[model samples]
Target: MNINKKTQTNDEGPEDSNVHGFTSESVVVSNRVPERSTKVASYLDCSVYARACGIETMRQWFDYHRVKEGGKPRPPGIPGDPSHQYREVWKGWPQFLGTNNVASAHLSDTAMSLTDAKAWFIKNEIQTVKQFRVLCTEGLRPPTIPACPEKFYNVKYSELLAPKSGRYLGFHEARNFVHSFEFNDYLEFRAYKRNNPEMFEKIPSSPDRVYMKSSPPEWTSWPDFLGYNRITRTRLEE
Candidate 1:
């Protein structure tokens, strides 16, 4: 068991001697926990380490890390228990809140917070999921932003950043909405969007690619959605 020598000393008050054998210096100072180098030993459910480090209960450690680390790059170790796995380090935090629950306080990579990243999307006019992906594939996205922001942030793309790659009206809803436009065919629908980009800001520019991949249940065919079937039937009758 490697002990942090930095936390070994400190002669202060009565609370100092209350902890099993560790000192206040070994635990927390000014509401700040130790750095990643600090080890939480796996014994008695890490009671010794937890108490020494100002943690009242085992479950409190989750809240501790959430507040301190923004729940990114998990702790170097988790206290051993029946339900929890014991490891020196976790690669990342699991999906929970699916929101920017904490400020980007401990993130070392980019200074941009979740809010900042979202703003960048709007500023760049990245309206659809496909467009965002193409930018990432072409190496046009900034290094400060992740190509898969959902994984990095432990939240779905639409939840963290809306539209994923484009507007996602539910499959049936999208089909109905597109049909209401009275487009003669898929090509005509595409041309309409291209010509009147501002009018369709909330709608995806490429429904065929975007909706087909996303909407598994209600997605039938582009021809059905874009009124191409109706056009084909009319042409055949004529």
Candidate 2:
């Protein structure tokens, strides 16, 4: 059956009420079929199946769990970027949606794998499962949810696009972003710059700080957003 169609289905999950008005049968997921319906897991087994659901889908999860007795405000166990404050990520697995070990071990001790989680939710009547799975699995599409509730304002504009946008991963909207690092990434950035020397003349941003070489802010933005803070691009080829 075409999951994208907005047709009604008798089979739905208990979580359907948490779907925020959308129905699972009407949602469209990725072309890839779910892994296996029987693959089981527990809520704590999240590292393997937590998917980067869309902003709207995340909102639905938040709403669904908030009112439930001993509910969760966010999906548990998925590793979200600290910089982005867990609002969004590159991608996530959905099998761990409501896995709250602390809440109840009976339901959390064993559940479905991320692959089966989508189908399970759909079967259980979670209307947003199909759409949520698509947004997270496809990785390049915008959400179809219209007119979100105002309570969802906590998710930022950048957070909404971060999962789907390569641009957001690299720099802020302004492009000229200054980041200070002291770890392996800092070493990698410096090394990358030394390897591919740009012909573009670079001015020193901070004479005292050797790593703080400066150039046109707009130009710096181009390389930075591309994950090349150390390398600069120019119209002229060296």
Candidate of highest lDDT: 1
Off by over 4 Å in 1: 1-4, 7-62, 65-177, 180-187, 206-216, 230-238
- RMSDs, each prediction? 14.4, 19.3
What does candidate 1's lDDT look like per residue over 21-121, in tens digits?
Answer: 55544444333333555565444323434555454422444545564556423334543331234322322221111123232443436636666676676
State the local distance difference test value for candidate 2: 0.30
Give per-residue CA lDDT, model 2, range 73-176, as digits (tens). Answer: 33332223221233233122232343331233332244333324423333333234244444434442222221121112333222222122221222232222
Q: Rate the local accuracy (lDDT) of all candidates.
A: 0.51, 0.30
Error of 2 at 149 (Å): 23
